[model samples]
Target: MSESSGEKTEQPTQKKLDDARKKGQVAKSQDLVSAALLVGSMGIVFLLTGNFIGGQIVGLTQKSIQQAATFRGELDMATAGDVLLEGLTTLALTLAPLFLVVFILAALVGYIQVGALFSTEALKPDMNRLNPFTAFQQKFFKSRTYIEFAKTILKLVIATGIASYTILGSRHMLPSLARVSPAETSQFILAQIVELGLAVAICFVALGALDFFLQKFLHIQDLKMTKQEVKEEWKEQEGDPHIKAERRALHMELLNEASAQAVRESDVVLVNPTHVAVALRYDRKTMQAPQITAKGADLIAAQIRKVAQEAGVPIKRDVALARALYELEVNSEIPENLYEAIAIVLRWAYTVAETHPRS
Candidate 1:
């Protein structure tokens, strides 16, 4: 069956997964990144508020207000620009650390989830994305859309509950805030806000963890391959079955041709009458022992005998020795076990050649 015809049953291959990742199609939850940033920023603010960040914010606010109050009735362009620049610089300095912390936390969270990935494919404009039908399908028809909607509702409900609980828990301290100094009142309010923010952030992180797993599960489901797709991928890596069979046939044919030439050069052919044949070559000046030049079974054995006969190479029928040599690979030296048998055959062939001196 074709890939389109069958159900996707097999897990995605490593190559497919890698290709998807290259295109920035990874199982990463935006909610996870947001939650991490929110939690990190809230924690930093909670820790640094009174000691560092809070002082900077208060100073900048007071300076801006004082400058605004001191400005003349008709503000010149130069004075206006100076005020704007001073305010912006102070604000930037005050919030720079917070922004930096949030940025690092967001990047770390994204990296933990999807590793280092930068793909322009997602940024590139696509006509399909502009389609109203496609947008409608994504927004309303997909289960993912419903899941996102549910998650949004869940976040709102949890945040509201956390805020209500924080407010109620601090209810008794409300009257005490009015009795305290201005600085004490500001600190108390800041602490309460931080506490509420931390609670909400904790809830978001828990929800994000769950959502991350869900996204991963959905991604795997989407990447699943059909049986036919697996087969096609196998073919792509290992070649088509028919092509492989033809290559094997060609290899065997080449081996047979080389074996026929080896038989012609051999000094002796040991045969199992009709079943097996082994052609051996021996040169006292060159070879250490009798080497099997060619070996085959059945029809190939008959062909070896015919070639040996045409080349005037002697044929000796020895069932045990022939079977043994047949078991050995072509062009290999005779084994120690068959050395005695092969030596005897060589001796006999040499004797025959000496007695019949060919013209």
Candidate 2:
């Protein structure tokens, strides 16, 4: 029956959706994350480290050239190592701003998509993933695999075209750069690179947004369940009807036992003569309002009255109040609208207690 999940004739139930979520399955796109990180970090890096990195590179290049010209110890292995180490350190420091911006952008994008979701279910070992047949099917047979392949090709083409167009636009500037100072050349290259990067990043963002919507639709379709699946899930969560019947019967039996004991402790029993009975309990020192300790009609009403009489608990006859109170649940506080009627009953019970106290 699990194989029939592929049919997906009906929309996914909330239970199925929630179960999938618990198992760390959710709609998300790697392309969208990539696009956001590329666009956001590129903009930030261009603003913060663009000039600094270009200047550093130019300075390092001039220093190296001057050192080579004055190379008294350039041939020594130790001296060569020291220069390489210094250049690497300088390069790393210069690129630190870009690395920081990319990291922050990635984290922010992840947060916006999932909002603190941390699941290890996906990381758990899966035998199916290791199987050659399964891998081949997923790679070549699935519709999603072909869609992804097409998207990747489209993106590559777009990026290549954008880069070529940007470079061609700067062809006239390239001839002038050859005759310019090293610092001026570095600045021109930096400007051109930033321009190309921003253009590509914007294009990727648009592609990513389109991919996200497409993926969302696919995810919904993939998760759809059949009518039989929905019915089985409902029974699993709510229990079979026969089982529910037994549960209800047991619950009522327990309530009957508890009500017997409660009627003995109740302050007063309100009765609709022979049809209804309602037991109320209250204490000035502990309770703010009278509480219905038990209520019933017909046979249950007769049993409640019998228990009340045997326990010496007071019985009051007020058909209107009994009928209203009978409608309330056992052990619930009396409503404010019934306070006036309840107070009168309590006063009467107090008088009876004084007149003929229970032993």
Task: Give me the candidate number with maximum lDDT.
Answer: 1
**Counted clashes in each candidate structure:** 0, 0
Q: What is the alpha-carbon RMSD of candidate 1 to the true structure? A: 14.4
With a 3 Å backbone cut-off (N, CA, C), the pairs that clash in candidate 2 are none
Please give the lDDT score at residue 204 for candidate 2. Answer: 92
lDDT of 1 by residue, 36-118 (tens): 98898787778657667767777778987888788657778999899889888987877777788889999999999999999
| Full-model lDDT for every candidate | 0.84, 0.82
Q: What is the TM-score of each candidate against the true structure?
A: 0.62, 0.58
TM value for model 2: 0.58
Name the lDDT of candidate 2: 0.82
Highest-TM-score candidate = 1
